[model samples]
Target: MQTTSTYKILVVDDDPDIVELLHYNLTKEGYEVEQAENGKKAIDTAVAFKPDVILMDVMMPVLDGIAACRQLREMPEFRQTHIIFLTARAEEFSEVAAFEAGADDFITKPIKPRALLSRLAAYARRDAQQEGLDEVIEIAGLRIDRTSYAVYKGDEKIILPKKEFELLAFLAAKPNKVFSRDELLNNVWGTDVYVIARTVDVHIRKVREKIGEEYIRTIKGVGYKFNTD
Candidate 1:
């Protein structure tokens, strides 16, 4: 299992106080930490730092967190990196936008240090569990490569954000087996993370958009199943 000391975190926010707070708390918990004041700086710093996780604030000058996350998701190296968005705005749109931009999780601020630490610890545990499962699932014409976090449909390469990719891969691995939203959340996002059932629906929609609707079928009242026939 990977220790907290080995985990690297990048804290991105325009507020100096927030940056300092996160840096202090993260380091105190034994994580290696780096700070970036804005989205552009975050990207540049991430290229060099290669953090395992990024804590990004939603609004900032020179580039917003959503756009930054979109750009980061495009980069092959950052595909597997966990990007969590922090925002003062608890608006539903803000949350939806964050997920659309490829964020792994969303947290509302007046930041609670203890809760945030618990969340980070959950990510570390998930990483350790993932180390043992290296697999590739080829279903129909779609190829889901867990090793590279890449997906290819026949000759076309598709880019799916980390969570979407995991959700798709989990379903594909057990073709024709139906999994409810709660089941998927527990398996893919883990029980420690407090993601809503709707998140699974949103991720499923995004996966289908990238890979085509034929691969995953909705069971209406129950949940979803990867279509093999």
Candidate 2:
């Protein structure tokens, strides 16, 4: 895992206390953290800082997290920003709204430090891959050399679970092409294993988390695709 100090993160929220609390823990873990008090500032700060991931509060003053995220999506530099919403609301609509607004994940507060760290680490792994350079099997930024289990981005290597690494290799071989969950199970995991479709989402979600959201695109109502461009 890449050290947190190497990763930059943007936090968007209306509450100063929440921002402070988050910053404290994030820093304690060695991550570089920046704060944006409202929706508009979140976009500006995120673009200016180019954080590895954004931990955004759904409700904020000025632009609000959802609006800010939409704006962020317009910037070419952040086409792949991993946006995780920090919200008090956990209703289905709220969750759907977050995803619809381009959020990558959701974490409802009161915060669980350990769980939060784990999720953040998972994202950081994805971010680190953005700089990888595995020429043999390249999918956007992820690299996989069948001869070696190691995956590198630029000069930095990414640590991944066995299944995760294999899954990535399978998908990177065909960048930006749509693949249904069933197809992936048959091609990557094989059809013999009767896995639920949620398993595919979970792995794809993790893949997007480590590789950046722009690294993959969801075809809404269809399947997930690798974003070759």
lDDT for each residue of candidate 1 in 156-228, tens digit (9 for 90 to 100): 8887777888888888888999999999999989887876677888888988888888999999999999998
Count of steric clashes across candidates, in order:
0, 11
Cα lDDT listed for each candidate? 0.89, 0.71
TM-score for candidate 2, please give it: 0.60
* C-alpha TM-scores of all predictions: 0.92, 0.60
Candidate 1 achieves a global lDDT of: 0.89
lDDT of 2 by residue, 1-229 (tens): 4577888889888888888988999899898999988889887788689887789998877778888877776565665566778889877677666655656667887867677778777655544453464436865565776445457777777654434555677677777778888887666544333334555677677666765678668888888776776
